[model samples]
Target: MQTGGHIAGWRHARAADNALCDAEYFQALGRTAEKGLFDGVFLADYVGYHPVKGAAVFAGLETPKLDPLVVLATIAAATRNIGLIGTASTTYSHPYDVARRFASLDHVSGGRAGWNIVTSTMENEAHNYGFEAHLAHADRYARADEFVAVARKLWDSWQAGAVVADKVSGAYTDPARISAVDHQGEHFRVAGPLTVPRTPQGHPVLVQAGASATGQQFAAANAEVIFTSHPTIFTAQAFRADMHTQLAQFSRSPESLKIMPAVTPVIGRTRSEAEDLKRELDDLIPARIAISKLEGLLGNVDLSGADPDGPLPALPAEALAGENSTRDRVLELSEREMLPIAELARRVAAGRTGHTIVGTAEDIAETLIEWENCGAADGFVISAPFLPGGLEDFVDMVVPILQERGHFRREYEGTTLRENLGLAVPPNGFDADPTSRRRPEIW
Candidate 1:
């Protein structure tokens, strides 16, 4: 159970405005997270522009960006302790290449690298990858299961002692210890050892963010860390319990996976100031943009004809089937609260379906602690509504309170990401012990 910061939302209006592509912004963000002794800083990814051609895509925070792994590499050079996690999609990436990239990052970062595995959900992403459309939800997960399996095999191809580098013996590597993966899965076929050696953490800690039933099963079998978004504590608790139950089916312990839900905090020295900041950001979002974004979240439902101040339109019966968990939450809230389209859009934009808190440092810290203590989450993937400023506030204001309460660490506990996250170094698959030779049950 630990804290991690996601800086994607930081590029929003009124906070670090127009600095999304700046390396310095990210470096400062990394340092701030490290200063707070946060476990990691995650960089989210999207390969294509919004499928809906609208202002939300043109005027939104998700503008063109640098590659996440490249961004993380820059962050790694600036920070000493914090883990750097980069999101890469399994559906669009080749396992061999993804394995090499993350493994290289782990080496360069002194083992503080994590790979956030995602099955590309946006249809635009599929188009970018030369596909007609995004794979169906279940099909995507099926591909992801094999994708991860191939990557794991490649990572394990080289044993721990594969690299001898003995100068006197005129030997660089132990050939006997290095072998080809020879993997031929339904979605991917990867051969031989990865270009890089076994990483510092055995392999970059596998992180997943899927929330579907198939997603939970894949995470239970493979993910060491699972990033999630839930609007309420009760839902988060239920999801965590479900993941643990899924873990048991894989013969894994509940402790094997860390469930970190997304939390966006708008904090100020005073509650009123926090409220003012939220209001400022909300006002900046045009109703058109908000409505467009909301439409995307609701399974691309056409909301243009609906009255902004009127109640939400009735959802299609099969809406939940193709939609994600966030959409489910949004629909549930709309139905329960009977919210107007305008109000619902604002709330969705504010937190993007995750829990959003507006308060002083003390209030924010108390809420976070309550969630952790109540089994709602193992920790949180903190989304600062705005960049350096929002992140800086949390690190400076809320972090101290959490530290003082002994709920969070004042200093990093370990060197590698796995060590810091309290995850065990996965046993090498080439090890002689039978227990150590089993592949990660990613399927």
Candidate 2:
């Protein structure tokens, strides 16, 4: 499948597990991914940790949440070919600031910025950000739609060649080159003529990671690359079909949005070795930690005494929150497969519903090609559980295999991320309007 890397678990190598990761480490990862012939590196960020029994969640396998924008900037400086994606929350941030931050990154990185838009879901995160509770899932998506609209308007403010650095005339930038978007939306009021000029790609690439009905609609209208999670091929195909339907509703097409589900690889030289590696990772997860994680995800159902070979405990109505869609979807998958309770939990722990492809490099390549060629997914957002080893193994073994086959790119085709991904460069807001848009009074 088309491959992309995510910087989630990669941040915990040196920093306190819960603290932010350093810029240098991310830069090194960017360089490594580029060398591996990967398309892009996406950074996933959460406003707050998952809560466990009324506390900010921090346990055996969780820690180190970094600000994705800062991390992306660092990586951008270190590498030129791999796309730099950063998660920006529409629920918590303003369109003006979001637009400016990404625009600056695009300029600094020579036009390789991508934004992963999300509606924040954590209650503790909401509290930390001055809210008493999380916004309802539907409501957050509604606000997010408006937020993106405003941000897009802001991004379209300045045209390329607007800045004529004419030293002879002492005019640093042509006054007649920018426009104002007096957008007054439900969630944001961004009066634009963004202070910064446009970047190589007029606006950074837009990405989304929500799977609810509202979120799917928003993505269909805006996202170029969608990061999704599905436990099985059936669900992934169903989701792909649903997203296509959404795209049709908007009179858009699937070609506009590339849907990539999260993926984890447990690779080894042999099938037995792969199985052994999976076992080792699970064994590292302590029982107390696993139980806490299971409860946090599947409601506080006490699975401590439940036999691994036994059936799953009954799910309660209270456990059916809209935000638990990712985990709940996995339960549905496990039940369909008739997997034992402990096996179900182990699979969930391994990748949090992202598919885990384990085996030799050829085995993984074959499986990924099948998934991509079928309607299962367009690509993958590759994630790993641990540090350098998790990424290093994939880059060393699986990438070359995929490259040998014709499915993956052997070399980057363009300098900018947008060009590399085969996306068109956007025209600035006022390239069509010379006189009217550039008036000083407009800003």
Residue 83 local lDDT, model 2: 87
Task: List lDDT for all candidates, in order.
Answer: 0.82, 0.74
lDDT of 1 by residue, 1-443 (tens): 01112223543443566666778878988998899999999987878755455544565534555799988999999998899998999888888889999999999999999999998667788898899978888888888888888888788877888799999999998766676777777777666667798888988999998787778888999999999998889989999998999999899998889999999898877899989877877786667767777887787778878899999978776665673765777888888778899989888877777888899999999999999999999889998887777888899899999989999997788998899999999877777543434332331
**Candidate 2 residues 72-91, lDDT tens each?**
88888788778888898988
What TM-score does candidate 1 get on C-alpha atoms?
0.93
The parts of candidate 2 lying over 4 Å away from their true place are: 1-20, 53-59, 298-314, 321-324, 338-342, 432-443
Every model's TM-score: 0.93, 0.89
Candidate 1 least-lDDT 10 residues: 1-10
